[model samples]
Target: MNRVKRLIKSVPGSTWAGILLMVFFAFAAKGYLSERNIMNILQSTSALVVLAAGMTMVILLGEIDMSVGGVLTIAATVTGMYLKLYETITVANIMIALLICCAIGVAFGLLNGLLIGYMRFNFWLVTFGTMSMGFGLAKGVTGGGVLSGFDTMFRWISTGRVFGIRTCIIWAAIICAIVIFVNYKTKFGLHIYAIGDSEICAQNSGVNVKKTRFFAYVLSGLMAGLAAVLLLARTNSAGATLGEGYEFNAIAAVVIGGTAMDGGKGGFKGTIFGAIFISAMKNGLQLVGLSNYWQQVLLGVVILAIILYDVINSKIRDKKSLRRVYSDGI
Candidate 1:
């Protein structure tokens, strides 16, 4: 009994909320719990989980990366064009295209890191600027049209089954695991939390604040690039809008997972659950016959509610601590 209680207590409140959400959906949507629907949810959420993992790191540093969506679009667009140029796509060609996507993403990330981390530029301005640049470049290159009909081999990167499981799911799991390991077991991860908590103090403690911040954004870009590959593969289509609104979804996942906007708290574990929760919410709502517009409104409301809960919960804990301190008279 004690062990069970301890296990329950160890789980975050948001995790319970996620479970409740799934249960509610299972009841509300007739087929929500079916194997097919469950598989759909997992597959659809794979890319999102990967994207949110990187956003988790960025949020952990108390910084935001606004260019992920744009990066994804541009990377996908460029890669799509590369595949289009080839009449017959080979495995080597697909691999090269994958590298192209990641390289573009990393280049943008490096630029963001150099400007914001080393040069001390405003993160918002720099990221947003790059976001616009990425979107604009993709649009110009594609001439405002969608890119589609890539070779089947190219699509296999995401749609192929690996050991009876979708490749995208495997990719997301591998990537999320790596991010979790880095966040928990690495000196770099410690520095990330420390810098987010107090940049000045971390600098005083011999942490490389700038380098950490730089790497955080770079990781975010890398994730976006990888997500673009998955997105392109799943949809077999790339367009100027292919990655639209992704950054919002990624941020929503991280925040919903209990990562503070101010940073220095929360881990990727929460973000993973948060990503699934968001995906489940969307899938369930759609199953419930809600329109996209209503879905957006509800998403905003849920985010606000979670933030309010956190604030109230923090105050209550503070009061309890104060009462204990007073009673101890120490």
Candidate 2:
């Protein structure tokens, strides 16, 4: 009985919201309950799951990575260029391309980590600046053009099916699983929560605040890079703007999943649900004939509502805590 209660409590509010949204959409949108549509939702949200998983880590530390979109764009663009250069793409070429994408992302991530974590630079300033630089570099490299037309094997990375499941989905699940394990079962994960809850306290307890913060950003960048590969493979094209608006969406997913933006209070499990919810919402809106513009408008409203709810909920929890203390003292 206690275990059941704990399990239920461990589930994030987003999971319930996602279930309700799916129920609503299933009735409202024809064929929404179909396996095809369900698979499509998972496929579309795979990259986002990867991206949000990384965002969860950063947010847990009370920091944000605005440069994720930029990192994805630059990584995808460079990797796309490499793929286009090849007439006959071998497995080796694919491996090299993956390396290129990850390297670019990690390099930028290292810069953000170094500046913000070690040098005591403001995280916002560092991440935003890197975002601009990443986008700029991608634009300059491509000369404001796009790269498209890749080998079949390269495309297969995302589009290929394994046991009737998209490879992208499989990759996302694997990555999310690893992240969840690291976040819950590892020392570093504990440190992330500690720092987010109270940096001074964590520092006094011998947590290497700088190292944790630095690695968090690096992981964020690495995930963006991996997401870039998935996105590139799916779209079969890459450009400077390929990753535009992704940062916001990823952040939205993380926040909507019940991870507090102030940090130290969320995990990747909620983020997976949140990503699926967003994808389902968009898919349902389209099925119901809503325009892209209206979808964007509704999305913004939903994000605001969720954030407001979180704030109110936080206040309520604080009040309850205070009441508990008073009662105990009495």
Error of 1 at 109 (Å): 0.6
Q: Quote the lDDT for 257 in model 2.
A: 88
Q: Stretches of candidate 1 above 4 Å error?
A: 1-13
RMSD of 2: 2.6
- Local error of candidate 2 at 188, Å? 1.1
Enumerate clash totals for all models, in the order shown. Answer: 0, 0
Residue 156 error, candidate 1, Å: 0.7
Clash pairs, model 2 backbone: none
Full-model lDDT for every candidate? 0.90, 0.90
Give a tens-digit lDDT track for model 2, residues 171-262.
Answer: 99899899999899999999999999999999999999999999999999899999999999998999999988889999999998888988
Write the residue-wise lDDT of candidate 1 on 93-210 in tens digits: 9999999999998988898999999999999999999999999999999999999999999898889998888888898888888998999999999999999999999999999999
